[model samples]
Target: MAKLKDKRREKISVATEIDRLEERRSRCQDNLERAEFRSRKEKLTEKERQELEDEMAIMNERVQKLNKELDTLRGENRKNMLLSIALLAISAFFYYIFFYNEEDP
Candidate 1:
């Protein structure tokens, strides 16, 4: 039960992190789109263009990092699930050995 709670907490935190990263990425994309539209009408100054590029790079890096973290969390969850299954199986085996019996005539 404690492990279950821990897993739930971890999942919640990961979900929250994913939501935050996605929100940030969307905001960055919106800014880039606006900048592109503006540039099409006129032209971006060199510094403005550089800043946009930097923001894009930073957003990409953050997305990649978030993806990696999510993968790691998935792996950990898989491992824990397997461990739990093994533990349950062992307990069941012990239960059968101790409690199961055949009738003797």
Candidate 2:
């Protein structure tokens, strides 16, 4: 089995991936913006329609990828939060059992 990554490293890895995804999304958005008020196809013929379809397809693919990346980021964040909570609880329990002695004893 692979060793589990520490929470900090996991967070950093997720953050890097998130940044890359956002960059790709921004590029896709830029492509669309650059194509605005202009024909995506070469001429006013079948080729032009095909070009438009291709652009649309690319845009849709990028959108889907971005959504997946966002979902992963959310999941990592949730895992980190839950892990922190669990650790805190475990630490408190240990303290109560050992270090937190009652003076009256």
Candidate 3:
């Protein structure tokens, strides 16, 4: 009976140690994430400051890839807008010169 009690106490001790380690790990993770967020926040430029709302969206989670995707989307949108405007202007000029000649020869 004494041996069984000792074994049970050993098991309880091990369980408590595991719980303590888990708590420490959770605290460490929280601190690390907070520090990372602080560091990233402190390094923004004025342009980036305007887009900090976007950074907050990704936060510390999946941020690198999300930021890359956001940048890519913004680039693509800008390129597409310039392409669209160029096409519109070229078409307007072509239409005017080909169909609306004011000189009668």
Candidate 4:
């Protein structure tokens, strides 16, 4: 119930975060490519090159963190699914014991 809703919300949040990180990474790569193109055409100042490298590093780190978070969410979902199946099986066993016995000789 409440736990299920919480898991769903967390899954959505993780997915959103992954999407955002991916978008940021794409933008950063595009900027890096533009800087490289400019450098080839003329020359990039040391500061500009350093800034581009720094931006790329930061974006890469963020994307890696987001990927890890997505993996964790997937693991949690798998665990929850397994737990639910076990609980359902246990409940059914108890139900059979309580009801099926009554119908037997």
Candidate 5:
């Protein structure tokens, strides 16, 4: 029971973290898009343009990192599911061997 609760809590926490990361990534993407539009539509000093480019680069990196983290979390969830299935199969096998018996008439 405790283990189950722990797993549930951990799953919830991981899901929450993923949600937060996704939100952050979305915001960064929006910012990047706005910056791109601004760069295309307006004239700027060379220094300002360079700064905007740097900011866009940082945003891109952040988006990539978030995507990688999300993928890793998804993979971990898959691994956990597989492990749970394996455990259930093992438990069922043991139960069948130990508890399921036929009586002779």
Candidate 6:
């Protein structure tokens, strides 16, 4: 029973983590787009341009990292789902075998 609660908690935590990471990734993408538009639409000093470029690079790296993390989390979630399904199937099978005697009409 304790293990079941722990597993449920872990699953919820992973889902929450995935949601948080997705939000971060969305924000990063939005910032990156704005940066790109600013670079293309405005005239700026060399220093300003260099700074923007650096910022964009950092944002790009962050977005990549977030994407990788999200992928890993999603994969883990899939594995957990499969495991749960298998466990349920096994439990049902055992229950049927041991507790589900059929009555003849």
Best by TM-score: 6
Which lDDT value does model 2 have at 102?
58
Q: Estimate, for each residue in 2-82, the C-alpha lDDT of model 4 and write its tens digit.
A: 999778766675446556656765775676576566656866689987886677677567656756765776677678779
Candidate 2: global Cα-lDDT?
0.75
Q: What are the C-alpha RMSDs, in order, of all predicted structures?
A: 6.8, 5.9, 24.7, 6.7, 6.3, 6.2
What tens digits encode model 3's per-residue C-alpha lDDT throughout 1-105? 999977875666433544554555456456557655765769867776656545544544444444454466556667877998999999999999998977888
Candidate 1, residues 1-97, lDDT tens digits: the string is 9999778766675446556656775776676676566656767799987886687677667656756766776676678779989999999999888
**Could you tell me the lDDT of residue 101 within candidate 5?**
64
Of 3 and 6, the candidate ahead on lDDT is 6
lDDT against true structure, model 6 = 0.93
Report the lDDT tens digits of candidate 2 across residue range 10-50.
55666676776788888887776665435643355778767
Clashes of each: 0, 0, 0, 0, 0, 0
- TM-scores, each model vs. reference: 0.58, 0.62, 0.40, 0.55, 0.70, 0.83
Q: Best candidate, lDDT-wise? A: 6
Q: In order, what lDDT does every prediction score?
A: 0.71, 0.75, 0.62, 0.71, 0.87, 0.93
Candidate 1 residue-pair clash tally: 0
Worst 10 residues of 3 by lDDT: 13-22
lDDT of 1: 0.71
Of 2 and 5, the candidate ranking higher by lDDT? 5
In TM-score terms, candidate 6 sits at 0.83
TM-score of 4: 0.55
In candidate 5, position 17 carries an lDDT of 68
Which stretches in model 6 have alpha-carbon errors above 4 Å? 1-12, 102-105
| Sequence-dependent TM-score of model 5 | 0.70
lDDT of 2 at 10: 55
Per-residue lDDT tens digits for candidate 6, residues 2-100, read 999778767677889899899999999999999999999999899999999999999999999999999999999999999999999999999998778
Writing each residue's lDDT as its tens digit, candidate 5 over 1-105 gives 999977876768566767877898899899999999999999999999999999999989998999999899778877888998999999999988877864547
